[model samples]
Target: MSTAPVFAGPDAAVPRHVAIIMDGNGRWAKRRLLPRAAGHRAGVEAVRRVTRAARALGIEALTLYAFSSENWRRPAEEIGDLMGLLRLFIRSDLAEFQRENVRLRILGDYRRFPTDVVTLIDDALARTAANTGPSLAIALNYGAQAELTRAARRLAERLPPEQIDEAAIEGELETRELPPLDLLIRTSGEHRLSNFLLWQAAYAELLFVDTLWPDFGADELSAAVADFGQRQRRFGGL
Candidate 1:
């Protein structure tokens, strides 16, 4: 539960993997006396900027927590706007992903989304599947607890309790395919994960940047990476 001490750097030595818990959109909008949807829309730009930054720097992977299962509790209009933005981003970014040589992969449950969004994401994933560059993984309709529960359920169905262990369960989780997460960023000064990538971020160096998601551009991200580069990742031992 302890966070790594804040470390500073010049951004040349960057971490290979960066995962983000995009927060503070609603608060950002509220402070402006605008609807929460406005902040959400602006956050999309931050996503693009951060992705571009990662790709330009030749980072191996960038995972974004775009939406969570708990988001369903929000009012209907906000939810609709969020879904609309998701579809639009997929459709529009399909070309950008290919042009930038970024591999796009949508993480989390696809079944819960509207049919149009589902198709758009499917097409986008297939279209950019050939790219072998920076991997942009977006988590939508995701909940870390839900992910763990699903993994546990799947494992439980295949093996008796006696046969399953930590390694086996980790393998069954969705984030298992990626290398161990190196850096985890959460915007808006929020200090907790809020059910983002529970299992994958076991050893990740956590960075809680104060910038709101919509305004978090490359410099802010670079600053966080600089901070991440200075910590001693002891994992579970000395």
Candidate 2:
């Protein structure tokens, strides 16, 4: 029996849109008898690795669930650490993005983030907008229910009772411009959406791995893609 997953397989097709549920940093730290902040720092490294790998593989779009609105419930210190890491990543990754021609975008409620952090995000996005490479979207303070509700409210405020249709609702969605998800992977083995890109990932092939975010690397991502290549996407019917 093959114990390790194959990184490249002829059966696997490259995904155009891939979303990741980055989970299990805390658990990973606890297991090592290290501080939770350590795990978070390690997870950030994993993010860099996966992004580079995806770009190298010529993936069109990569979306990461960085921080959800519910994450505010965590300790203030941890939040601070996360925000610090985010800031560092943005400042340092800009050159890498320019080199790779990658366009960086933040997907979520900007109002909920700190003013300074929001400013940094905006600047980073603007600077990379013209890049002709892969689009890397980071979800911060995002909630699927909140996104859907906001979309619906916008529609209600703009139109009366005559133009309600699937296309209308979809047009109102935040992810209207992005392609439908081809694969959704969750690290740390928790098989739940946790309120991610609910509308977009409707029929995406899901892969749940036992590895934690900190442990996930280029090899792990490649293996997931290899698995994706083996599956025949039927959408609804075979």
Candidate 3:
């Protein structure tokens, strides 16, 4: 692996932490005349591919928006399919993750899932807890607004208003365990945050790509990272 700084610097070639909104699985399925479930399955494959690519590229952390809190509003059947897919992914990939030294982390309140799903997630988290490789954070049942609200409540309960500053609130966030977000990518040509990492993205570079989640792979990821390298990030300065 390349020995490069994960944090922002004048010569940083790869982001230390990268977050992705894996969007358009359903649309990809519709375009192919396949069930949305199939698209999601393919999306899982993409996840595997991208995880390996990120690790190979020397990224320290990768965050994926797998499922949102609002996803509960989706149809029950679709939700069930997604849940099943999650179980399958964890069961099939846990060993590989361990072998690759990937640390699995959940960014949202995953306990709200079905008992079995929750059990599987907890098992995965524990099993990979000791790994020192790249961190992979899956955002299941996550929402940026909700995260911020919960962080605020936690701070309010522990500290007075005067002491509740940015650092305190960020320390309360789930992402505090992960690296500072350096690059955020949204796929399927969408150009929105979609309630993800609002606080951590304060100075992170944003990239929108037309590739659907399932179609995303190493090449696309490398291209995006290359594009990111070419841009001059002033971080709101001249």
Best by TM-score: 3
lDDT by residue (58-148, candidate 3, tens digit) is 9999999999999999999999999999999999999999999999999999999999999999999999999998999999999999999
Model 2's number of clashes is: 3
lDDT of 3 at 183: 90
Give the local distance difference test score of model 3. Answer: 0.90
The residue pairs found clashing in candidate 1 are none
| Candidate 2 Cα errors over 4 Å, as ranges | 1-12, 160-162
lDDT string, candidate 2, 1-238, tens digits = 0012223345666988889999989999999999999999999999999999998787888999999989999999999999899889999888999889998877788667777888888898899999987889889999889998998899899888688776787787766666667889999999999999887777778999999999998899889988888887765654
lDDT of 1 at 45: 82
TM-score, per-candidate, Cα-based: 0.91, 0.92, 0.94
User: lDDT at 60 for candidate 1?
Assistant: 83
Question: Whole-model lDDT, candidate 1?
Answer: 0.83
> Could you give candidate 1's per-residue lDDT for residues 1-238 as a string of tens digits?
1224333344335677789999989998999999888999889888888888887766788999988888889899989999999888887788889998888877789778898888888888888888987888899898989899988999989999999988888788776656567899998987999988888777778888788999898888777777776677666655
